[model samples]
Target: MLRMAAILILALGAPAAAEPLARELFGAMAKPSAQAPEAIGTYARGCAAGLEELPESGPTWQAMRLSRNRNWGHPEMIRFLKDLSLTARQLGWAGLYVGDIAQPRGGPMTGGHASHQIGLDADIWMLPPSRVNLSRAEREKISSISVRTEDQTSINGNWTRSHHALLKAAASDPRVDRIFVAAAVKVEMCRTAKRADKAWLQKIRPLYGHNTHFHVRLKCPQGSPSCQTQKPTVAQLSNGGDGCDETLQWWVTDYLEELRNPPKRKKPDGPPPKSAKTYVMSDLPRQCAAVLSSR
Candidate 1:
């Protein structure tokens, strides 16, 4: 609950005086598919048209945190999850336990991340699904485990080959742009995996706070011209070396410490404080404005 409260502060409640326009407008949109499922603008600051919801439960996967109503995503993302889960099952692993995809109309959310705004990113719990018969209440009550150690440099003892296999399958998928996991996991993979297969490590970029679940980001699909590309894309990361370079050490040491104890800031000298740099309609690609009011 403390983490959730902090997320609310940063993403939703920071500016206490008035709600951001993008937040207010996007928050009011409750239902999905009021328009076509088109992704517009970049992942961190964008909007989606015609959103689709993953099923509450699938044969090989189940969506969690349903009350947030963030199971919606673009058509490509929904299909990617379905296909990825199938691949996992074929790889002798259980299905995925999916997390937030996007809001009904991808934009600045009430809490959590900024990148899910465009429906191309999804979070899959590192926990392997045990069975296909999980209830919505079970999904809510069950918790994912933290694979990171106290120092944030390695996975806990509970880490298994299945976890590695599941993530590798996701990364190997052509449609996936990159998969974000704990930095320690990257170092472990670099040390243990075969030389030829190490190339896949490039896509498993390390980040803090994903010890419990890994976030998967997809490239903009063909024909989605409005979908903006991100900087230093997955292709760029793979060009020089496997992403398991010195960055892994930086992520665990400096980055992890910073994330745990962000610097304190005084209350706004001018105003209560405003939304993040990317949380406004104008900050997004112009096509996103149409996406916002398309219905």
Candidate 2:
């Protein structure tokens, strides 16, 4: 009986170390490629492995907010940025100013973004980049301006064709799954883009609070069987749009009403603001935990 009790106690005490919350583990990740490059799970509910950091500067582009240490992404996303930077200059833009890509292991972000949990999403500032060499302090000090009016009714004086050209270059990329921008930016695109370039309009998705920068997400890389792709949104599922559609009209109506009367935002329904349950490790794919555990 004594031996059995001792065995039981040892068993209970064994593996007593608590598992770290997913957000906590991911947040603490300092580097990438702890393992092979593998994007696992859905965007909001996913994590990635084998992440690589983007170079701080290139011939035509420079990254910002380096202190965040979010200039990392999957190899495909890094390549996409490299190609897009070159293309932007050729498309007559001065250069590109990139923002966050992903954290090293790519899990639930403690700060901005409900997505970008995988290595496929990135944010590029709308601020035109004329100079490729910007000091860390300057990069942090400079702010991107919203193209929307103060009232948010429509594009403001800051809106220019240069913005359109930059967006077009990003949307035109075949590897790009979608680009999220403000409704006003989409409305402007619908009004101005020539018919020949309208196919790219399908990839430009209008979402809230992207007036100062555009969000770009890439499609799953070929041969990535474990990577989950998103289902088609109503916009993507419904075919055939030259950008002039009821969707755009609805956005305009919504914008007008909001300007006249902004609705109150509801508090989130869930565990308290910083509850550990905020990021359920099991909610992510099994592979993600493995990614975090690797070197």
Error of 1 at 179 (Å): 0.8
What is the model-wide C-alpha lDDT for candidate 1? 0.77
lDDT to native, each model = 0.77, 0.78
TM-score of 1: 0.84
**Per-residue lDDT of candidate 1, residues 1-295 (tens digit):** 3323433443453563332457656766776646766788788778888889999888888899888889999889999999989977876657888999998888878777857988999999877777867877887889988877878867788678877877788788888888988888887877787887877778898876788899999988876778876778765865756776666677767887887899897776764433433355555566655555545
Off-target runs (Cα >4 Å) in candidate 2 are: 1-20, 233-235, 255-277
TM-score of model number 2: 0.86
TM-score of each: 0.84, 0.86
The Cα RMSD in angstroms, rounded to one decimal, for candidate 2 relative to the true structure is 6.0
Report per-prediction Cα RMSD to one decimal.
6.4, 6.0
